[model samples]
Target: MKKKRPSLQDVANQVGVTKMTISRYLRDTSQVSTALRSKIAIALDKLGYIPNRAPEILSNATSKAIGVLLPSLTNQVFAEVLRGIESVTDSHGYQTMLAHYGYSSEREEFRLASLLSYNIDGLILSERLHTERTLKMIEVAGIPVVEIMDSSSPCIDLAVGFNNHDAAYQITKEILKSGHSKPVYLGARHDERTIIRLQGYEQAMREFGLEPRNICTDRPSSYSLGCELLKEALRRYPDTDSIFCTNDDIAIGAAFECQRQKLRIPNDMAIAGFHGHDIGQSMEPKLTSVLTPREEIGKVAAQRLLARLRGETVTPKILDLGFTLLYGDSI
Candidate 1:
């Protein structure tokens, strides 16, 4: 009889490394060093073993990886967020795993537990208070946790994000100063971040004695869909002069719709966004938004996790990296 195929376990047996490290090499995650990669390559060649690429990593041996849970990947903003998370995770020799929750709390809860089943080293969560069960799970996940973009909640482990309440308050206040009272909020979900941003907008509008207009939180994939939503908003609330998207991607889409309507940006209708991105800047009128320290967040989150892995003390003081407001033509 012919010899059987060598498994990841067989390779691990030969290489003196974890099966998870072998999977990291197979996935091309850049978490392993060249020496280990070469060793794995030699093992594969010698044993004629192939990696299984089905249904993600199957066990905790494979799950010792770094898991990044997010709303979606189509958005460039999220891509940057991933870059930030990966940049640090890579530097520390941890493989990166990914899961998309589709901006749903229940979905996040499911994926969170699924990723945890793998016994990942740490987790980077995009939204907070997504679901009741997710909160419960976080309370006992027993690993390093980092919440990005919205850090209002009492995160169990680590947090590297902005004060959405303050960011929304400041941006809304600027819009009020520029003479626009009826600004609709565009967002993907009504999670903790969205609630805070909406609250801040309401707080500012009330401070200026302006009744907050209709809060239409429409979630869409592309420009055409956003255009339709904005068109309806324009018809329903014609006095609405400015638009504030929860993130820069939505703002860019809203701007496209504004362009299609033949509206001069910042003149006929001013537009602003949050999470300043290069895509936002590449537009005709550079997006006036908040530049969340993405790279810094990633680097810092990684450092924090590494410190914990190294048994160092981390506190809330240094973890508070704030946000900066960027003003532009659409102000």
Candidate 2:
């Protein structure tokens, strides 16, 4: 009922070469003469032969593939990070497999299991907070792991990210120095990073002897949610002079809401956000944000994994890439 796939021997016979010669040619073209190489290539094309990699995989135990786990695809920040990863992986002749878990540790565990079943060489994870089962599974896999985006939690193997708490603290202090004491924190998702950023904001407010207000949501960060949070913040704390959002999405949303309310930037209400997302700068009153090195984190994480795979030593398991605060029209 189905057509059989052509084998290596079939192509070898058609090319008038021994099976071993065909095998050597397939592995390395440089091993064969130019005329023989051309003949083998022609035979492969004529017979529609596909080289079976199962035997090589059985001997090497490597799929020549790396697994990357992401939280949400909607977040535009990962685009740059993925680009950096591909820049390294492609050059090294390794492929990447991506999986998303919507920021859930349980879903992440399942995805990790699936990736492991394929015998991936290494893994790149976005979150540091993993379930106990996930941790055990990663330990058993015995593959190189690199965690990115949050450096607050203890890492499994290697960590490449910035200190989210310190970044938030520095930005919040800057807002305070700009003469906006009545500051409120706006956040969403309430993930690990969200909590850390909140802690930084709270610490800054407490150090300055200013009472902090937090208006947050359990939903994922979005422009719409930002507007709702800002609306609620204004209603509860009518004198809310400054608002620090968890990410750029919420900050942009808050900026739009401020415009609808006819509020002047920094004078009536100052808005600042985390992550130097492009839309932040495109705004009429450009958003002030904490710029995390997202792309460098991805690039460095891939490099470390590749080094481990190549049997090279990777020093300093933990890496803090650092962050920058970009001041703009919106304080």
Candidate 3:
């Protein structure tokens, strides 16, 4: 279990005063004796009681805690983004509460409802489940909601995501530039992000007057799936020279399959991935990938929510966190 955070009651007991006086001091209420204020302030420092400064709009509730609802924490993409979100939130003395719904819409709704029961000031929704009911609930909740990871929809007050089409097109173009006429698209079927990446690959290939047969999306990538898919894709397109996985995990699997078959990384078959997972950098032949601005996106989303909570009427509905190409040994 975690250590208990000292509360105002603790400070009240230690300062030898009623909770009313402590509340007055926290709110900077006048009509308190100077000597008593000093004693209470000292006790506050000694007991380490942090005053929760939430937006005043709630009127009945206040909190410095924000809730994050994502698909899963096992994925390193979420971990890196959380790192960025925490970097800013910790400095501002706010705490983050994480909840994994594993792509279930019902679970997401439940999580959102549960967070409302607490005194949370804001929420970061990484997935885009823009149902009318969800929107209605958010409207009644009287809090800020920021969308992350996907940029296709602006159903919320704020959003943060990169141009999926551009990122994929650039990576695919790199594959073609390296003398690979037919490159394979390796990944799962995502929502709009996946569709954009698919379009990007098709668009790049079509620009070169090539057919759009150079693509294959799959279930979440694993060594087994990578090995199995690589065998079939290579057999079908024997002249294929490169493979671009949607995320780093899939790319890593493809790289491993090439190793098992004694294929040189870029020399034999170029490989790349998205999400820029940390494991890619440490692989035997480092995997080339695109580094999404996970941290910046999280930080920006938080800032937008804060702005909304402060009653700002700014239209920051769309935020583009650009991508960075990581040219590792594989490329």
TM-score of each: 0.79, 0.91, 0.81
lDDT of 2 by residue, 101-194 (tens): 9988899999999988777899999988899999998999899999998776799999888999999999999999999999999999878899
Q: What is the C-alpha lDDT of each candidate?
A: 0.76, 0.90, 0.77
List RMSD in Å for every model shown. Answer: 5.7, 2.5, 4.0
Top of the candidates by lDDT: 2
Error of 3 at 153 (Å): 4.0
Question: Looking at candidate 3, what is the lDDT of residue 296?
Answer: 82
lDDT score, residue 222, model 2? 90
Flag the better candidate by TM-score, 2 or 3.
Answer: 2
Runs in model 3 lying further than 4 Å from the true structure: 1-11, 24-59, 189-191, 213-218, 221-225
The residue-by-residue lDDT of candidate 3 on 132-189, one tens digit each, is 6666778897778888886665556777888888888898888888787778876564
Compose the digit string of candidate 1's lDDT tens values, residues 147-226: 77655667656787778898998998988798776777665555567678888888888999887764455364455545
Best by TM-score: 2
* Model 1, runs deviating above 4 Å: 1-64, 130-132, 136-141
